[model samples]
Target: LDAFLDAEDVLKVEGRLSRSSFPNSFKHPTVIPPGHHVTNLIIAHYHETVKHQGKGFTINEIRSDGYWICGLSRAVATHIRHCVTCRRVRRPVESQRMSDLPVERAEPTRPFTYCGMECFGPFWTKQGRKQEKRYGLLLTCFCSRAIHIEMLEDLSTDTFINGLICFIALRGAELDMNRLNVFLTEKQCDFVMNAPHASHAGGVWERQIRTVRSVLNATLLLSPDHCATMAIVNSRPLTADALDGHNRLEPLTPNHLITMKSTPALPPPGKFEREDLYGRKRWRQVQYLTEQFGSRWKREYLHSITTRQCWHSTKRNLQVGDIVM
Candidate 1:
C-alpha cells in the first residue's frame, strides 16, 4: 500500500517490484482517486476496452494496464449500474413475486378433482409396416399433483373429446378447470384454454407437457405405445422431498395418490440397452423404453422439480417511464 505524489503532481503506488523487470507503469501503477471524474473516465475507457464485459473483466483490464482506483470493485459496480449501454445489455426483465396458490392448488382434493390439461407430440410410431404420428393429451391434477396421459390420433375436436373421455373413464368424471371451456358440450363438461400468445398463463399444465415431452423424446425409439409414456409421466414424485416419516421407505409419487402405489409396474427383470429399442421383439422394445424412462426420470426430472429454478425472489414493479428490452 505504499503511495506517494510523483513529480507530475499525481498520486501513484510505490512498489517493491521496482527491482523486477516489469514496465514502470506496472511497477508503479498510477493511483486514481475514487468518486473523481478522472476515475470514472478511466474505468469507463477500460470497461469499453474489454468490450463491456462484467466487472471482473473491467477490473482486470484496468490493473493489467497499470491504473489502480481506490475501492475499485465498488466503483466499477456503481459505474456499470448506471452505464446505459451496460444496462441495455444486461438488465433483467422485471418480475413480481409468485402469487399465492389458489384454493384448487392449495387444497388436498382427490386426484383429478381439480385439474389442468395440455397436449404434446406427433411422436412417430410404427403400426405394422407404416409409420404413424401420435399425440399425447395430458391431464394434471392440481391438488394431488397426479397426472393422466391419453394418446390422440390427431388434433381434431373428436380426437380431443375421445381422449378426454378416456381420461374421465379412468380418473373419474368430477373434474374442474381453472378457466373452464366446454370441449364436450354434449357431456356438459367445461374446459380451459390459455389465450393466444400467452403460454405462461397455462403454466401448470405447460410445465407437465415439457417434462413429459422430454421423457418421450429420450425414451421412445420408434414403436412404444403412448400408454407406456403415460405411466412414466404419472410415476413422477409429487413433492420436492418425496421421502416422509423415519422409514423413508418410498418417495410419494403421483402413482401413489392415483392408484395407491409407488411404482407404475414392476420393471421387467434385467438390464436393457439401446440395441433393445430396435430389436425385433416388441416386449423388449417396450421394456427398453421403460428402463430408459425410469433412469432419466430419476436422474433429471425428479431433481429438476425439487427446486425453484428462476424468479426465485421478487423485483420492483416496472414504472411508467421505464424502458425495457
Candidate 2:
C-alpha cells in the first residue's frame, strides 16, 4: 500500500480522477496490489458482460477501454473458466488410453452366453385388415460371433421377460428345456440396465442393429412386403453332417450374416455341424466345448493385446482447478 502511494506500476482504473495511488476506479491511473480481491471481482464481472469471451478478448476489452491489472491473463482465464455459460459449453479432452477388452469379450464362452441386449422399432406389420407395430429384441453375442433375435409385442416388463424366455428356449433345446416359468419372486433373476445417456456402453449391440437396419431397409424397398423380406432375411442354408476333417461344425457366424451379399449365402463358416452333439446329457459335451473355446480365446486375446490402435494416442489433459460442465 505504501509503495502504491508513489504511483509505481500504476494501472488505469474506471473511477473518476481521485487521490488514491492504489488502483482506484476514480478515472485515473492507479496501481493495483497483487492478489487484490476487488480487481478479481471487477474482472469477473467484465468477463461475464463480454459473454464469456476468450482471455485475449476479455483482456483487450478491459485494458484498452477500462483497466490494466498485473497477471491480467491469469485472472481472465480463471474468470472465463468459472463462467456459467463457458463451463456449460466447454468439453473435456477425451481419455488417451483405450480400455481393455470388456470381461465378456475377453473371456471365451458359448455363443450368446454373454450378450448385450437391446430393443428397437415398432415396425408396422400387416395383419388381416389392420396394420400393427411390432418390436424386436436383439441379443448380440460377445464371443463366438453369434446372434439370436426375437420378436417382441410391447415395451412392458412382462413382454421383455417373455422374450428372454423365448430366446433361452430356442437356443437351449439340448439343455433341460422348460416351458414352466414358475418363478415365485421377481428377484429370481437379476436384471442389468445400461445408463440412460451412456449409449457407448451398448455400442456393440448398436452396431449390429444398425447393420441389420441398413440391410432390412434396402431389402424392404425391393420386396415391399414385411413377411417376405423377413423370410428372406431369416433364411440360412443347412449345415452338412460332417466337415472333411470329421470335426464337429457350428452354426452360422454373425460376421457372415452382417456382411452377407445374398440370402441363403451357403458358406462353410455358416454351417453348424455340431448339431449332433445335442443328445441327452448334452451338458457334459457343452462343458468340454466351452473349455476348448476358452483356450482358443486366450490365445487370440494374447495376440490382439500386442496389436491395438483403435484406442491409441493421447488427447489434451484437463486443467487443474478449472471449471467443467
Best by lDDT: 1
Across residues 140-204, which tens digit of lDDT does each residue of candidate 2 receive?
66654455567777877778778777776655421110122443123143345689977766776
Q: What local lDDT score does residue 100 receive in model 2, on the 0 to 100 scale? A: 72
What's the TM-score of each model vs. the native? 0.59, 0.59
Q: Estimate the TM-score for candidate 1.
A: 0.59
* Candidate 1 per-residue lDDT over residues 232-295, each given as its tens digit: 7777765555355786535556665566322333366887888988889977787776665455
After the best TM-score superposition of candidate 1, give how far the Cα of residue 34 lies from its true spot, in angstroms: 2.4
Question: The CA-based lDDT of model 1 is what?
Answer: 0.74
Best by TM-score: 2
CA lDDT for candidate 2: 0.55
Residue 178, candidate 2: Cα error in Å is 19
Error of 1 at 177 (Å): 13
